[model samples]
Target chain A: NAGVIQTPRHKVTGKGQEATLWCEPISGHSAVFWYRQTIVQGLEFLTYFRNQAPIDDSGMPKERFSAQMPNQSHSTLKIQSTQPQDSAVYLCASTISAEQFFGPGTRLTVL
Target chain B: AQSVTQPDARVTVSEGASLQLRCKYSYSGTPYLFWYVQYQRQGLQLLLKYYSGDPVVQGVNGFEAEFSKSDSSFHLRKASVHWSDSAVYFCAASRTGGYKVVFGSGTRLLVSP
Candidate 1:
């Protein structure tokens, strides 16, 4: 298996621009997770999907962050009007059970 | 609210020396505990996990963790270290009823030759 696949290993966006991160999960895995990592905040859970349905997004910023998993194989995390504070490593993981396999994250940089 | 805490922000050890990374957790229920290592520019990889049964669990690459409910801690240990073992370690937990996994701030380990 390829584990999980995330697109654009690095992203650069100007302030007020938008950033969309992509993730392709492992085949047959029913769960997907998104996390953000920054030096100050450490690692924070952003959102998650189970069986192609959003289960919980309490960690997400209600105004600007959004996630969608329209199908089983892939999911997307979109940030509208990206701000400098949004710069961080966006990680994605997929799992069939308790053990989740992660992809090399996309490093988002907002200037 | 659930949280994981790794007290040490950074740890340095000589190669061949023993290693220990501390972790403490808070949760309303008996949660599933895990230790993950993140290599440079790579995603976090699971080293070990604790559910029930034995308090001490063995993991890949000779890594093991002992869970102490009394202390509310799950600490990762390695008998001997190598240069390749340098990475950031994260302590995490998940509730049984949900899939939201909470993570610690992580402890960076540096193995010096």
Candidate 2:
């Protein structure tokens, strides 16, 4: 199986620009998760979906961050007016049981 | 709220030496604990997990963890270190019926040959 797949292994955007990262989860998995990893913050939960419906998003920043799982196979995380502070590796994962399989992640850099 | 703490930010050991990484968690009820490893430029991979049953759970690559409810701790250990075992290890915990997983800051292990 391909596990989870993320698009645009790397992304670079300006301070005010917007960026969208995509993820394709394993087939038949019911849960999808998004996490942000940084040297300072470590790994932080951003949001998650079950059966294509959002279960929780408390970790998401209220201002310029949003996530959508339009279908069972895919999900997207969008950041508006990106800033250097937002630079990090955005990871996507899917779970069938308690164990999760992660994608390669998209390394986003804002300059 | 649930949280996990990995006290050591970095650990180094010589090849063929024993190793141990500490993890503690806070939660109201029974907690599901997990150990995950991440090599450079790679995604997180599950090493092992503890739900109940025996306090000591064995995982891949000869790694095992012992969970202590009284101390709220789940520490990972290996008898002998290998160069391939060098990676950033994270401890995570979640309550039953909760989808959210709280992760620790992670402990980076460097094994020298």
Question: lDDT: which candidate is best?
Answer: 2
Instruction: Kindly list the per-residue Cα lDDT of model 2 for residues A7-89, writing each as its tens digit.
Output: 98999999999999999999999999999999988898999999999999988999999999999989999999999999999
Clashing pairs in 1: none
Q: Please compute and give the TM-score of the first chain of candidate 2 against the native first chain.
A: 0.98
Model 1, A1-111: lDDT tens digits are 778999989999999999999999999998999999988988888999999999989889999999999899789999999999999999999987777789999999999
Candidate 2 per-residue lDDT, tens place, B34-73, comes to 9999999989999998888999999999999999999999
Which pairs, if any, clash in model 2?
A: none
For model 1, the chain A TM-score is 0.98
TM-score of 2: 0.97
CAPRI-wise, candidate 1 is medium
Error of 2 at A90 (Å): 0.3
lDDT, candidate 1, B1-113, per-residue tens:
78899999999999999999999999987889999999999999999999889999999999999999889999999999999999999999888655668889999999999
